[model samples]
Target: MIAPAAAVTTVPRSVRLGYGVGSFCTATVGAVPGLLLLYYMTNFLAVPAWLAGVVVTAPKVWDLVVNPLVGRWSDRTRSRLGPRRPWMLAGALTLPVAFFLVFAGPSLRGVPAALYVGACFMAAATAYALFEVPYKAMPGEMTHDYHERTSLLQWRMIFIGAGTAISGVLAPAIAGSQGAQGTLASYRMMGLTIAVILLLAMLGAFFGTARAPMTGAPEPDRGGWREQFAAIKGNSAFLWITVLACTQMLAVSMMLAAAPYFAAYTLGDPRSTQTLFAALVGPMLLTMPLWVRLARRFDKRGAMILAALMFGGGTAAAMATPLFGALYAHVAILLVGVGIAGVQLLLFSMLADVVAADAAETGKRRAGVLTGLWTAIESGVSSFGALIFGIILSIGGFVESEPSRPVRQPESAVTAVLIGQTTVPAVIIFISVLITLKYRLRPPAAPAPAASG
Candidate 1:
């Protein structure tokens, strides 16, 4: 049987733009929290490294449950605004407010402060799930053509680069330095700024995709997720892609979490956080079109392998930052940024394919569960990167300090930060390259031409 919308070869550029605009939500939310939140908790709030890790990660644990439920709920809904947009709208209303409170509330340090931040972060995570799981579900439903999905996701990659660039560079500038000393007010302001950006992007996507086609059938899976899990268990391509995405995201998250520490201790300049991010996101922005072409030439599998190797090698080389100095580290990270473009584009594009293929085969609306599980894995491992780095810092005896009470980090802490950012993530990313080899998503064959009378 022909799949739904199989004959629809192209998504309108406007709808692509509208859908792609939502990535600002993912990139901004993902980059800012990973970049600054751990540092914010340890330095500004005086939370211990291990506990700060918990504050960053605990909220994401909530995702493993909530994301799937949101996915399932959307699959069942029949609404005038459509199932996904309503959830997107709800998230837009709630996340910005919750995100602002994360940094703006309760100046008290230690456990009291940690609890306040943790609760706010949990709320933000839930809000993110509301939009993100449903948002993720849309690309697969938008069209069925394999290459068209890549073309569609090309827009998302560009927007992701922009959002990541804005958040990565701007957040550090707004949050002050690593110590952030005596400038809690600046951190609060940064939160407000990021919140506003999130609001605008989410709302823009809602309005932008005003005429997006809902090609996927809305026959909700009545059986619980156990049935969906069984379906996923048999799907090898889906499983491998999930592994690749999760491992890569974990590495990215670890590096993002360690950026502030690396700038201050390893590079001897806290301001270099902005410079490092500029280098990182600059390459990401400039190379996205190149990566999209590479996906076409090499196929997503070969392209992913190349991208993973580039990221791992560049990140591993960055471990020598102390020996080579700032320029060398910057150049190495720039190379890593190039790989990041392909990694994200291919991963997202392939995900849409696998989900769409599954929906076509089963003749059920299981994309929600599939995407829910994917997001849960993505969100879980991504946040786990922070937890892993916090463990590394604790082992190195890093000290926590209030904004008014600055303290020197031991050489051991500095070394730990460098290793956490470079060596650990490099190894993890290389592991993803191996998993990428296991992915074998076959593109659907084109329909036969009609015979002449």
Candidate 2:
């Protein structure tokens, strides 16, 4: 049931920016691991491709259980800091330290190193959920106006662009450029720098949202997981959107996991990973307003379909890079970046609407639980990208090696990276477009008339 926009007082500029900067946490934590972790394990830790996939994936599957639990906990928490911020604070404190340790470990290799990375990655994933699940729920609580949520998430997308640029472009440069992909010091430097970025962004969000107004949300107690599942089952909009977004995430994750391999082996340069990231994220810095306008004109679901087409087209076009060369790949990725800007902005904006609509209909505080379930599914689905790519690498006979002992991969392995990054992701994205067609959600009721007094 859609609720009236309920005369939502526009969120303050300070609070909006404060809330917006939180994506720094989301983007960095989301990007760094996908961008670097798989390659890091394969090249530096000497973990075989298939086991490395398991190490990356198992921790995220753990989130399928943990994230929803934290969401439910925050939904019930009572404090001066509010239900969400307290958990945000907790994640801010723990994730940076755990992230640092994931890369800075002893010079262990093979299965032992894989185990160490898995444990630390698991801890980092837990910490991320503490901040992310609750933090994502805030926009739904911040304002009820449908258009206003779009405005608010615009600020967030800007920060997301910055965060992704740092993680996607700068992190790779630090890891691969300073020495090579084979240098322990290079990977350590990459880990430390990214950790510091995570700390600053997470802390900034915790403090920035101090003054934002919280519209009331469902305060349902932990009524057990089955009840929670029942609530999710009943929200059609929420279910459809989650399915749509998770499919999109799987596509993005595959691209991130295969990027370094694609650059080093297919494109003939390791440093090209940095340039590829720049092309992928650069348009985002300037395109949010255009996306917001598209949402206003076409509605979010329509805009999402258009964006999906662009993304899928770009991904498919890039498959010709080996034939057309790197310049063509960069241009194709630029189109993907423009599409990414719209999709990223609209996905969360529409999500806020779904949660807010559910709150109005149910009269229960299930934002945490709902967002928890959302995060858990998104994280778990995304892990499939890395896992699938890892399997591809194994089947293609990609060789694993330590930093000090690099190995030449087979011609088949290079082809595997190419197909994984381009053809597979393109197919997944087209499927998401089909899912988007099913997500015919109503926008929130139009804003109530304003008073002049």
Candidate 3:
């Protein structure tokens, strides 16, 4: 029989706040690449659209191997600080250096520059995996209370929204300017600024959770990697949740990748992209508590279904902006933000419960392995979003131009941008809702008692 979980009954607010701050690091790293990397490669570095796609997508292939290993490694580790904190600390120190190199590569053009940027980004991706997998695992390790897990993740989601908004607003405003070289300089400056913020946020999480209680002992050495893989294969709930989460992640990534183009081509002003992004993300902060309450009152899957409908309806309404003007589009985007908030808050919370349930069934806590797989799928699919949008742009015959010389897109390309920004994500969100319905996980239960001798 499975043993009862020795989970911390109450986590301090300070610890929760500290953990929540780590989202700032994740959001800054995630947002910068999704929001600007494709634009940087094509517009500033002058790489072809197809090549830009390859460069951005290639580095993430590393995560498929690294994430699982890191996850398992942390599971086996025994440390003075904790199994996860060392990885978190190491990631905190190295990520800033990698972030700086991503934008500050030597002045080279064509394949050479693409190679340099790709190599730098691979390092950044590694650092992110090291931090993100362990950090995600903590929610399961920190508490076993089903409702409390949702509450903890709610704070993280709130900060995620805030951090996304900060990066969305600041990166564009900093990078907006006159010429190609000037724009490059602006990106470099923005990179450095974001790097500092990432470091500080990560450090805060490391120290803040230093004394938080751990739930279970590390699993004893099993057969090998095959055994580890087998563990994940048996968890049907985790598999379904991964699919549902990955679809939402891909949709969000595609929208982020297409936002600048949509602003330039459809809204007729590139600067407006930042404002649109802010509109899309700001409401998430205010709406997260409501989402958390909904999840607590009903169920995460139900909340996700509601979110998907809202997101699809909002996206469809935004597609009609050409007829009604930018004001109508902004309101529609706010609704999308609300939907995104619900999805983000509920998905991770649900994953924590899935992990707890797995522990109950198997009598081992392998949160790292599960969280690793989760992060790997999330990173891999999101990166592919860049490639998908790139193919769309290439097929529509998008015009490539330097910052100093703006080019007007043909109607076909403009239409492609609009479709990418709207219909694509709306459809993906609906599919995610369908997948979520298949997820069947019970709430946390007390362990059954051992039989008498």
Candidate 3 residue spans exceeding 4 A from truth:
1-8, 177-182, 217-221, 445-453
lDDT scores for all predictions?
0.88, 0.88, 0.83
Tens digit of per-residue lDDT, candidate 3, span 1-453: 123456546668888998999999888887888888888887777777778888888888788889988888888778898889999988999998998899988876667878999999999999988888899989887876777888988889888998999889888877775442247788888888888889989999899888776664356334477887887888788999899888998888888888888787888777887889889888778988888888867777788899888887898787897898878878999999888888888889888888777766676767888888888877887788888888888888887656656666789889888888898888888888889889988564566789999
Q: How many clashes does the backbone of model 1 have?
A: 0
What is the descending TM-score order?
2, 1, 3
Model 1 lDDT tens row, 1-453: 224454765788999899989999999999998999999889878899999999899999899999989998988877998878998899999999999999898658899999999999999999999899889999988887777888889899889989999999888888883344327888898999999999999999999988988777557677776777888899887888888888999999999999989998999888898889988888666887788788879888998999989999999999999999999999999989988888999999999988888878777887778898899988887889999999999999899987666898888998999999999999999889888878878665566899999
Q: Higher-TM-score candidate among 1 and 3?
A: 1
| Collision pairs in model 2 | 218-364, 218-365, 219-365
Residue-by-residue lDDT tens digits, candidate 2, 1-453: 458855775999998888878898888887888988999999888899999999999999999999988998999999999989999999999999999999899989899999999999999999999999999989988888888889999999999998899899888888876565647887888889988988888889999999988885646645787876887897888999899889999999999999988898989888899899999998778999998999999988899999989999999999999899999999999999998888889889888888888888877778888889988998899888999999999999899987667778889999999999999999999999888888766765555689989
Worst window of 10 by summed lDDT in candidate 1: 1-10
- TM-scores for all predictions: 0.96, 0.96, 0.94
